[model samples]
Target chain A: MISSKWVVLVIYAMEDGPVRYGEFSRRIEGISKKMLTQTLRQLERDGLIERDIHPTVPPAVEYRLTALGESLLPFMRQLKTWAAANLPLVEAARTRFDAQSLAE
Target chain B: MISSKWVVLVIYAMEDGPVRYGEFSRRIEGISKKMLTQTLRQLERDGLIERDIHPTVPPAVEYRLTALGESLLPFMRQLKTWAAANLPLVEAARTRFDAQSLAE
Candidate 1:
């Protein structure tokens, strides 16, 4: 569930604190309403996030990380760090591999 | 690419030493040949694995982690560790969420 690219961005948005549905839509650019809803539902089902429904005019919903989700944050951050640090090398390798494939 | 489930299993298979294609197909049960080939090619292009071909009557091909890939092993292992440790909680949370949903 967490492996999805949307999952990563959603989790990152929740890093600070609880985020309402509207706020999530705003914070994560390029995510359609359908995708955001689906991601949130999946995270909630996985027990990585809690969905709070406020008893208001329209029942405002907010999402926050559970303890399990919070624990996963550090590891996810590490993966992000690795990606940022090594992307150049990875790109270079891809270029070389493509060139070699063409030669062969 | 790293998020692919096949990628994780493939990396794990190469942890001890270089692994032959047949060995990988055997080690990771249920992974189709097409998937294995695709995963290997992707890893090769990303510079995370080295595909070594040895000259013989029938060319022997092996796959092993590159230095950059080795660096990523620890972080990947940590993710595995976290999953192993917290799976029960996640499962339990899911059950609870499901039960509550049923009532509502």
Candidate 2:
């Protein structure tokens, strides 16, 4: 199964168009090389991305989101928007929940 | 930040309405008691759910999704639908990718 967070991150990161492996590595910060490789492979396996290898001196490679992958963006974007807008509400709730429990 | 998978699962599982702690454990097959509690707390803190405690011999508690949480269902359902429909394609891609690596 796909790691949903990485799946969303990679797909959203590649939203523009094709990106080479090194470029993807550069774009998403804090992703370990192993995790990045694994996430890419899994996304490829899931048909969310197409990895194209060009036959060159060292074989250049690139990645892009597939139609299936693009299909997820609208929903992902909406969630991102919702989260951003409601963060303060969520934080306030956490504060209240903690204080209530502390008093009990 | 939310643990997206559990957030989705718990929200979807509670789509019906309010549910008690013990019942939530029963409904979600693999969630441990500790994990269930933690996930619930996080969701509550996020203001996605309202947890109500009734006064009784012992306190009875129940959970229900808030309007903000229900607002996400449309997008979630679409992704779920897309995933279900394209699962075969993803499986095929994985098999081909694996076979390709093995052959190389």
Residue range A1-92, candidate 2, lDDT tens digits: 54456666778888889988888767887888888898898888778899899998799899999887887788668767877887787788
- Write down the lDDT that model 1 would get: 0.88
Please give fnat for model 1: 0.80
Kindly report the docking quality category of candidate 2: medium
TM-score result, candidate 1: 0.88
Candidate 1, backbone clash total: 0
Position B102, candidate 2: lDDT:
96
Give all candidates' CA lDDT scores: 0.88, 0.80
Per-residue C-alpha lDDT of model 2 across residues B1-104, encoded as one tens digit per residue: 55555666788887878888788877877888888888888888777888899897699998998887777677667767877888888888889888998999
* Candidate 1 lDDT by residue in tens digits, A3-34: 67788889989999999999987888899999
Model 1 spans with C-alpha error above 4 angstroms: A99-104, B98-104
User: lDDT tens string, model 1, B1-104?
Assistant: 57677888899889888998889988998899999999999999999999989897699999999998898889768878887898898889889989999999
State how far residue A92 of model 1 sits from its true place (Å). 2.0
Error of 1 at B3 (Å): 1.5
Tell me the spans in candidate 2 whose CA falls farther than 4 Å from its real position: A95-104, B101-104
